[model samples]
Target: MNFDDQPHRRLNQLTGEWVLVSPHRTKRPWQGQEEESDRATLPKYDPACYLCPGNERAGGAVNDQYDGVFVFTNDFSALLPESPDSQPVADGLFVAEPEPGLCRVICYSPRHDLNMARLGTERVAAVVDAWCREYEELGVREDIGYVQIFENRGSVMGCSNPHPHGQIWATGATPMYPASEDARQAVHLREQGSCLLCRYMEQELASSERLIFENDSFVVVVPFWAIWPFETMVLPKVHMTSISEMEGKQRLDLADALVRLGIRYDNLFQTSFPYSMGIHQRPTDGGNYPHWHWHMHFYPPLLRSRSVKKFMVGFEMMAMPQRDLTAEAAAARLRELSETHYLESL
Candidate 1:
């Protein structure tokens, strides 16, 4: 089957979801100049930076002199713990629930100049340890049901801060996306008597076309059903449902995978790559989710050129998500690129 000829195709494993990949229309060579900018050279220590050590935040709270990984409650949290009970308006059609959750910011390092890609493997491991601590602490809370760890890099990704950091959101219930995945996995497991993602990972590993990089513990691949041009997912070889369940070595391996993938992304455009990345794991609702698999998603916006980005507009907004590049092709390109930063030579 010529995937290029087909206008739309449905992914069977993902509940028959369709994506429009207009490869012919977007088959153009990249023509963007790589320019050096002072913005990339972040300061080692910014006295005025709110996230830096020994700095005062907006709410009159001061940060301690943290050297390694540090996590603190978001100065401005989107979800508060002291929310009132959810109220329903009209009938069951219109309902609103009070969201009670915790938002935390995890500082990757004391140095502001280093991005995730630039941070050494050992330093990245420290960040993973901090994530484990946060997950365990927040997951134990009776009020929390899901823990989301994510990073938004570059201004294009709507990140106001340039510091090397990520955010953690622990909520009262499983989110819509994860809930959908959970349902699908459960259905697949009941039908096939095996885990859904585990089976898919096995197929992907055998194909090897969509794979970007892999170590003993983790595999980074551009999923066959990826919606973004440069989208990728980092999956664990072993089926660990949540970060809290990860052992010390697995945690370190995860951190190493993150740093390596980040370095590749930065090298791709020779710029600080903009992406919305997040992890998907089992919910903390106390039920055993043997079907669920742990993975991280990286969604980058750049399409044919660095300056020109793909937007979900017109048909995409009205209909379904679309991409111009196939996942296999994207993965091949990323695999060809070196993990080292292009800017390191300059």
Candidate 2:
């Protein structure tokens, strides 16, 4: 039976969740909502932008005149580092505990116009190095259980500023999705005596059906059970526990993969593609997790054209996530896009 022609559900091995896919739905008419394109000609540096060098932020803190990548504590952090050690026990259903953590913002570049796609490979490597440093430092802290590095690109993805930047949130508690992924990976290692992602990556590489792009050290593929329309995962060929484990050459190769993929994404829709990208790795709790295999996830909302987007409503909120595009079709779309940026091509 051809899975692409029929309505079916696919299981996510890492998170143990099912996603409903209906390939025929893509042929239906689009009478739903459409979003305005946020793409525009941006200046190299915005004087009023808080992330620009030597500018005053919204929280009244002035940024230093730094070059290249700049790191600083978030002006308005979500988690307070000075949270008191206290727990309130409830009668039966309610229980709470104080979470002590810290947040940081990393300015990818002083230039306000460049996203990862236009940011040359050399500068992208610098960002990768900064991620390794932040992960290593935060992982050693006694209070931080998980260090999450993520970026929300475009206004639709909740990015308030257009500056090329990302955030690192070190928290005392592991987030829900990562917690589920960690559990499933550990179970796979114990039961099958192999890493979960490593095995999954092998199958993807063998077929190349869902494979989009690859470098010497990393491979990007639309996972078979993707919930988002253009969701993809960057899996390292070699099994490593965390971002810190990447070797010198591996770091550069990973940076290449990122730039190429970003360019393809923007070129595919001929606009600034929006996505919520994040890296998941071993927890910072100093536990022996040989089962942990680090990977990066990209969840882009654009389903069809630049104006149309996939919203999670109705069935997704009440039951489970659903998608009209199959993984193979999404990969084929991405795979055919040029690695060069569209503006350069024109």
Per-residue CA lDDT of model 1 for 37-135, tens digit only, reads 323566799888888999998889998899999899998999889546555466568766666898999999889878888888899989888887888
- Assess candidate 2 and give its TM-score to the true structure: 0.96
lDDT of 2 by residue, 1-346 (tens): 5777899999999888999999988888978765544456799989989999999999999998978999999989999875465666776887766778999999999999989999988999999999999999988989999999999998899999989999999999888888999999999999999999999999999999999988899999999999999899999999999999999999999899999999989987788889999999999887888999999999999987776889999999999999999999999999998887887844
Best by lDDT: 2
Superposed model 1: Cα runs more than 4 Å off? 4-6, 12-16, 28-39, 84-92
- lDDT of candidates 1 onward, in order: 0.84, 0.91
Evaluated against the true structure, the overall lDDT of model 1 is 0.84
What's the distance in Å from true for residue 105, model 2? 0.6
